[model samples]
Target: MTLSKKIEHLEQVLNQPAENFANSFKSDIILFFDDNFSENNTQLFFLNDLNSKEEIQSWVEILTSRFVMKFEAEFEAENDFINDYLENG
Candidate 1:
């Protein structure tokens, strides 16, 4: 998938109702990065002007590792959501 499509997928996942624990966990990841990278509600600064697949993957990898490390217990139950979000792109 293209970067744009991946972003769209993220939005799709986030739009789902957080009625269950699994969906809520996915929302947490999406919301964290969305707020973390937001600047006046614009594109994510680090993700903006990306030029290659490696750069995108690297960014995702770094973010995923850091996020997982910071929230290991919560991430353990829904690791695949992050993996799919990053890798499917």
Candidate 2:
């Protein structure tokens, strides 16, 4: 299906009552369309942006950050910088 249809489908799925869905669930949604299609790809990207918006309900959280268990010294060194910014700013 096209991106628009995929987005509409997601909205419909999310519309179910709280009891209908599990507390933690995983869904993989992909839009299959030819690259040479005439329509602009912007609409697809826009819909993705909406998915991460705060206006959406509780279950819709965008995994937009790097979720890593561990990293190298370089990454650890920056932790102080981040913490300082958080403390000061």
Candidate 3:
């Protein structure tokens, strides 16, 4: 997906009512610019305005599963740290 499209999709996910994020936290988004998406400076936002242990665990699961499925080794050999962080951080 294009950078803008990815951000738009993520925005939709982040804005979902079921997420139950703090209003102030919603505005404090953390976006990571990936070298893998250097063509468009694709931003990967793993988590945002998370305030509880459950949210943190949810973010970890979401990130780990997404990374393993989308960015498996062959495409990101040099970015092992990123994948590791996503899984273990």
Candidate 4:
């Protein structure tokens, strides 16, 4: 798949509900990267031809940072809800 298509797929996967936050999210993200690079040699070649290692690393870092922020926000929201419930109940 093209880079845009891969990104689109990633966004779709990210939007899906995770059954278990830790296992499901980690595995799904890993699987997405693995399938794109390892299983699809063409995509690996395309990336190599189009971008340098640093550029690719930067992209990965950006995505990772975004995921971290999202996870932190979700965790905080859940924690707040639980605390409020305990206090009120």
Candidate ranking (TM-score, best to worst): 1, 4, 3, 2
Residue 87 error for model 3, in Å?
16
Error of 3 at 58 (Å): 0.4
TM-score of 3: 0.32
Q: Which should have the higher TM-score, number 2 or number 4?
A: 4
- Give candidate 4's TM-score: 0.35
Question: Over the stretch 1-89, how does candidate 1's per-residue lDDT look in tens digits?
Answer: 45564454445545657564434454556665563323443444334445555555455445455554544665464445455444554
Candidate 1, pairs of clashing residues: none
TM-score of each: 0.36, 0.26, 0.32, 0.35
lDDT of 2 by residue, 1-89 (tens): 45565455545544444452331221211122122222354423434434433423332332101112222447554344323322342
| lDDT score at residue 55, model 1, on the 0-100 scale | 59
- Steric clashes per prediction: 0, 0, 0, 0
Which run of 10 residues does model 4 get worst, by summed lDDT?
80-89
Poorest 10 consecutive residues by lDDT, candidate 2: 62-71
Tell me the deviation in Å of residue 66 in model 1.
15
lDDT for predicted candidate 1 compared with the true structure: 0.50
Best of the candidates, lDDT: 1
Q: Compute the lDDT of residue 15 as modeled in candidate 1.
A: 61
Model 2 per-residue lDDT at 6: 46
Which stretches in model 1 have alpha-carbon errors above 4 Å?
35-89
Per lDDT, what order, best first?
Answer: 1, 3, 4, 2
